[model samples]
Target: MSSGKYAFTKALKELRFHHCQTSPQSQAARSFLVRAYPTMKKHNPQTPILIREAQGIEPKVWARYGFGKERMESLAGLDEKAIESKVTEMATSEPQS
Candidate 1:
């Protein structure tokens, strides 16, 4: 699926984000989601995008690919731009062996 600047690849099945809503470490992830969530959801309406929050957990992002394969990256201490770049890359690229 293609949206203005994002073209999600077919290999990507779902995206999951986990963060602590009240922790400073989650600040960037929250900010990135605020601005990017709408565009992502609009473009890939069928894909599951889940956001989970807790009280003191570390922030992270998960990308699930075909055949139940998955990859995860830490988001703790990352800035909004870095988080965006990581998510864009994960969302657009195919699973790597």
Candidate 2:
């Protein structure tokens, strides 16, 4: 029999499951994310990136795991550059694997 102590704990990072609509603005954001993805992968390669056409909606971030408490973050306020900056900032914060 094994000891009572826990085996291990793994960090379930909030995946970037982006829901983008079919529009000029959403398309732009999608392009920007596609470009920035490789850089993010260089750090957290396991980070899942999925894109789906969300009708009548602007580009937004939603949860893939955990309780649904965090508000849906709209990409409306951010341009392509802002998106790149945010991605870069997040990549830097993660510990290099």
Candidate 3:
């Protein structure tokens, strides 16, 4: 019984470590995406370097002003609901000339 508990604890620790590593990778990816894709770097020109790392459809601080596959793929892992919400948010938040 104690061995089983130890194994579970060990597994959880390993999972946590993996999660931590993936987080930085995703953050770096997001940062690189913002810079490599022009549209993403357009919005809020003052802080073009701000990279959004949220999982849901929050307006990416980087690519809030343009449209394309670059935008879609930046949000590729989000679910339908989150994507819809992001679309709505983007639609509402666009700056009017």
The model with the greatest TM-score is: 1
Per-model root-mean-square deviation over C-alphas: 2.1, 10.8, 19.5
User: On lDDT, who's better, 1 or 3?
Assistant: 1
Ordering by TM-score: 1, 2, 3
- Alpha carbon lDDT of residue 5, candidate 1? 49
For model 1, the run of ten residues with the poorest summed lDDT: 1-10
- Reference-based lDDT, each prediction: 0.89, 0.51, 0.31
Cα-based lDDT at residue 80, candidate 2: 78
* TM-score for each model: 0.93, 0.56, 0.24
For residues 1-97, write the lDDT of model 3, one tens digit per residue. Answer: 1212112111111110011123533443444343333442233233323333344332232223333212222334544445434533443343323
Minimal lDDT window, size 10, model 3: 10-19
Better of 1 and 3 by TM-score: 1
For candidate 1, write residues 1-97 as lDDT tens digits: 2365456788999999999888888999999898899999888888999999988999999999999899999998899989988999999889988
